[model samples]
Target: MAQQATPVRTARLGRALGPEPTAVSGAVLLLPAGEEISARRPSPLLATASVRALGRRLSRTGREDGLVAHVVHYRYRGWNGPEAHLAADADWAVEEVVRRYGDVTVCLVGVGMGGRAALRTAGHEAVNSVVALAPWLPEEDVAASPEPVKQLAGRRVLLVHGTNDERSDPELSFRLAARAKKANRDVCRFEVHTDGHGLRQYRDEVIALTEDFVMGAVFGRALSRPVQDALAAPPPLGLRMPLAAGFGRSLRH
Candidate 1:
């Protein structure tokens, strides 16, 4: 019998666009999606094509003139516990990015537990915008989590969740958005398809919103009208779902 070759695992590269700012222009944080166990171990949820595509879209924003994108990796609490520890870690990461990068604008993007982390990070001084995908900030956890709304008041936030997500209901995202809006923050919400707590169905809209949010934060422009209009349109479907077990297989490159 012939020996079987073991698959090689590649480090998921965190990409930055534009020159490292002499004074940091802006920073975007990307957190892994899933519960604590899933987050600790590699899973297809984090390596989906939509996830990679979102990263690429964010990287493109960094290529724009006068803007830089800094992507940082952080650990988040999936379903293991409430978000206290994850929030603390997120705060530390945000502060570190600000300290190292200078007075850079900050944007937090999280999917699932990562979304909760992003909201927690929003309490930091440098965070100016947030994009939460199917975030898991339950009402009970809000008291324990940092006051992200206070820190993010008057900032721009885009919340997207799948109505079919069973892990964390989309209505929770809506409730969070409502709180943000009440604080006079610029908030936008989008609903997508899928029942497994993933954002595969809303990839394009998510990417566009992310780009728009970052650009708007750095340059003081309103979200691009086209992007906003597109988001307002009805949700689209038929996106191929990535296999949770096969994510690392595609990283051979």
Candidate 2:
């Protein structure tokens, strides 16, 4: 007899960031929706289960209880694009989500190269929080990609990596976090089992940690109910144009 598939868990929540039409006011977390390829496939680090578990935990914090969470995926490519391309693309997605859902909180979770892209995008004006799992940063000894570490100065950043990453040096993320802390930024680090680079081994812990970080950053106790209500309301229709276009253009400039 064939074995039954493991049932995947899922969670949904609301957005709490701004008052806009497309803002995603809710979130969903569950197992990724696609077939699993070989271990070497370059998939996004934050899998479906990660999103669901994280969303559930965030709901408990009373901050993102109703926010809608959706699985987010970005195109993969070589990192030789313009300096602002990655950031712009990230901002555009955030805007698109807001335009569709209405002022909402956004949590971008990434691993490996995706983590690097998430860091680059975190500093954008539109991003709310960033969680990077086993992220890779450009090495100084090699031709370096544009450094996005500076943009992380004022943002909330979470870096999770294994000590035994062979594909990319985990120390790179540590050094990046150290630099961010040196600049007085809000950054957190989590070191998981030192046996692998991807987060498959420590999924639960990583999801819980990510949920806590997002709640703390996006819904700090200081946020007032009026702000929440305002975000829930509709946003001006055309005001978002420049923001979207500006971000798109930044990628090519």
Candidate 3:
């Protein structure tokens, strides 16, 4: 007899910050990065720290909008090949949010490998939008199938990549964004020049862009000129729109 595959355990939703569940008008599920291959149960993912910090910032930004933020703690520590355990964790998180909040809109925000998970899970009914920061997309080849973009339809999507990223290739994200845009015109990408996979150099600017996109998607607010332009512009130009310095500061006015 063949050995039975081990069933994955349920993912946990980290304590949220912001409005109470009963009062939340919108929610953001934050996903964290992980390794390429590992099945070890994640006692505590280091990547969760940064994403939690981001959630706190977003929670504050969307306080007036009644947006609550939750971090997803995956059942496993890695993407784990085609199983895509991270994406499954994200899906569970979305479902839990829906069960708790009932019809409230949701925005998925993730970084690195977690970004890939957010994009993969955006097809969920509760997810109105997704923000992928330095998403790790597999290179297309005979051995590796390309990530599907059809799932992104009817959902607003934003991909941010650092041009100087030493880990995940920025070009790969550009290609994915181009494909996703064709599938859903709402999809757009931004390039942070000279930064790495972490996008730390333009952290504030990236966060600002994310906040604007998430809030607009959740509350039907008007998007900034740059985002609107990027979404309306054609290929290459839209996929490679530069994230300018002081971009965050500019949003204040």
Residue 209 of candidate 1: its Cα lDDT?
Answer: 53
Q: What is the lDDT of candidate 3?
A: 0.88
- Tell me the TM-score of each prediction against the true structure: 0.69, 0.60, 0.93
- Decide which is better by TM-score, 2 or 3: 3
* Candidate 2 residue-wise lDDT, 138-167, digit = tens: 675546553557777667666777767787
lDDT of each: 0.58, 0.50, 0.88
- After superposition, the stretches of candidate 3 with alpha carbons farther than 4 Å from their true spots are 1-8, 19-22, 43-45
Q: Pick the candidate with the highest TM-score.
A: 3
Clashes of each: 1, 37, 0
lDDT per residue, candidate 3, 158-199, as tens digits? 999999998999898898898888878898999999999998
Q: Per-residue alpha-carbon lDDT of model 1 for 1-253, expressed as tens digits? A: 9999966433232555434434456677665565554335344454333355565556555644434454444443244454455555567667777676778777777777778778767867788877777788665464585335666675667777776788887766766666566664356675664534765555554556566666776566665553344334332310111113222222210
Off by over 4 Å in 2: 1-64, 77-88, 142-146, 221-253
When sorted by lDDT, best at the front, the candidate numbers are 3, 1, 2
